[model samples]
Target: MTAIALKSTLWSLSIKPFKRKGGTNLLLNASDLALGLRGIGWNWSQVHLAPETRPTSSKTTFVLWTLASLCLHIPVFDALHYAVQSFGPTTFGTINGGSIFDDTLSPLLRYSRSTFISFLSGLVIYCAIRITYDVATVFGIVVLRQHPTQWPPIFNSPWRATSLSQFWSKRWHQLFRDFFVGVGGVPMTYMFGRIGGVLGTFFISGLLHDVGLWGMGKGSDAVCMIGFFIMMGFGVILEGFWRKVTGHRVDGWIGWIWMCTWLLGWLNLLVNAWAAKGLIGSLFIPDAQRLPVKIFGPLS
Candidate 1:
């Protein structure tokens, strides 16, 4: 089975230890190993024919992406985020550099606003990333003159996701998928069962995310983020059951609603906790008078 194969691969990676001369284990922070393995430089040794045309433009892709990033960083992204929270029954605003948890708002309204802001945040981020990728890739083709034998896709229309499995495997980016699989998913699948892979992947991701949250001053809310991911793992399991029982996965508007209920709806906890702890503040530029950068920004 696929799980068995993954388990074997994980075992092999575990036993085949490689260490830096300075005694650092890159595996400890799996990102390093994953990046190294996935980087084009690492795989370029393989034989491949170069593309016939290596083209780049100054005005089209790169310029547009730079402008988009500017808009998101300057006005639109943070402005929209602030407007959503303020427009709601509760402001959830920053006061004296802290989050004011206004209780005047109804929970339904609060959740709705949170969902809206999160949606906007996600949309801006997606656009930013896509544009950034476009800029870098075009730069490579034109400036670096590196001919891509085959260009990998930037995304797979994540909105079309019908199930958590499809979302994770197909819709979502695969950059960190290998990290979870190699680090925990495989062993978990072997020890437990099919669901083990799901749980293991999610839990490992949760820990990583918790670390990130803690770093962002959300140490108090890190547990919420971890729980959020574990909940997603469980949701994935339930989706699997739905497919088995109904002879189809949740799809169409129903599927979208189901996915959003858990993914976006459940996100309220993490975002609320994060907002309370001033963690969300780290994400955007300060009010018009300020910017996202700070003293520790370089190190962060």
Candidate 2:
């Protein structure tokens, strides 16, 4: 099958069960449970075009998807953040302080420092929460398979892959990526190249996220929205260069570069967390408590 077709099949398979009774199965067929499955599947397949997947006209489907996402996301993100805090060496204070430095230099330098720092802090917190949720899910899946009753639903399986690209493809929100691919990927690829396609997809995804968060009165989310775009842009350029140098095949030195790229992406989680914490504390903490802040300069 073609790449788009394969993506469509995967999307359909992943979301089909939600349309069924009890939302417990993955098969797709004509049934009351599949009420909005067609819309979801068609949208993912690029067969249906709408301003957005959650059309205003389909109040029922929109509500269902929103509620479902909330239920699933809340617990997962909470646990993920908890895991990082409890196990990771770095503290939240350090992360907030570090983020300040990130914003001080970003395009937001034109904006108020306080406002930029505040938004960056919120983004870091949100990302930490998401990471916690993902990690907890993985732990849950592994333990549950051997002793189902011993583990509560508090955690879930980690995504299916360990690498950054794999994580992007499998662990992160599939619907979000699929929607971007359908809406923007083809045009970007046609206009620029594969690198442009990836970067454009991520950039638009960031903007969409920012707009949504802004509309909901959460201006802080824009930090993450912008951060994602920047990171993805850098990644796309790096990947393109690597592909060209490696003759489109990763082997020998090319493999090493690829591995390093993946490692750098994962390390960004810690780097970003540090930057965010640094930024937040700089704004809220008192001068007396600012010694550590100054020493770390926002990444303390």
Candidate 3:
């Protein structure tokens, strides 16, 4: 329901006509117009009929690839899900068994545990999104008879990102690119310049995320969501400053270290906020259906 609402809202805000073939289309009747708008709303990335080099894969190959991806991701997701469940929901900074904020533990142990949980939560989210994208791509190509080009890979090796700008713009899934740029980036660019545009886009992204949390009855925390995103925007700006001063782009091992430190260091703002609200207890896959849970039982 949250997704549908958000997508519908994005569609409403879209200025361009999301035709399968771009440009003007003749709508004979109200039904045609309605269906056309519905189709546009359904296409999250607004993919259309466009010429591209990548050829469509065989049905057999597609099935095998998707299956392999699921085989790899399912177990990973299940393990993280089990671990998250074990931590259980935090209540007023306390948990049933243990927590990242447990004062009884040493400072090193607490920080390390929090960082690990944050990393696990991030991976779990990535797996869930990737699996969903793969299944949806298959359904679109095989069942709906949509062109494979319209369903390009949703992600492009985000973990390899060496810079904040590269991570957000090039590597990460750009499903919300158009929406963010159109609604926030463009206007801010006109008003205050490129820096403002970057900050504004991140601000909107943070706002939307917190809104989603609020819609889910989790009670939004602006400090967690908005603060994290704004800090990321500043990180991108700082990288730009470094390049200007040093005449060297942020890349290689040094860049990777800096990126990891920035992300992981600030990640707790979002992760701990969700954990406090019991979001970590939410299960992605049922325990009875998880192979690892069946074989080895839940994590201790």
Query: Candidate 1's residue-wise lDDT over 1-300, tens digit each?
Result: 333343346547664454332323444334333332223333221222222232234334544554464455444544544543443222234421233223567977756666776666466556555555556655655654444432344557778776666676667655446657666677789999879988888887777666655665435555677788788899999988988999987788788778877777666655666566554444344443433223212211
Q: By TM-score, how accurate is candidate 1?
A: 0.66
Candidate 1 stretches greater than 4 Å from native: 1-79, 84-102, 124-145, 148-153, 217-220, 283-300
Ranking by TM-score: 3, 1, 2
lDDT of 2 by residue, 1-300 (tens): 133443454456574442322233243323212332223323223222222333334434444444465566554443333333322225333332333232435655523443333343334455544445334434433433212221122212222333334334443434355546655565688899877677777766666655644453323455565576657556556655766886663335545455445544433443343344332222333534544434433332
Q: Who wins the lDDT comparison?
A: 3
Can you tell me which runs of candidate 2 are displaced by over 4 Å? 1-164, 215-224, 248-300
Tell me each candidate's TM-score.
0.66, 0.40, 0.80
Tell me, by TM-score, which candidate is best.
3
CA RMSD for every model?
Answer: 8.8, 13.6, 5.0
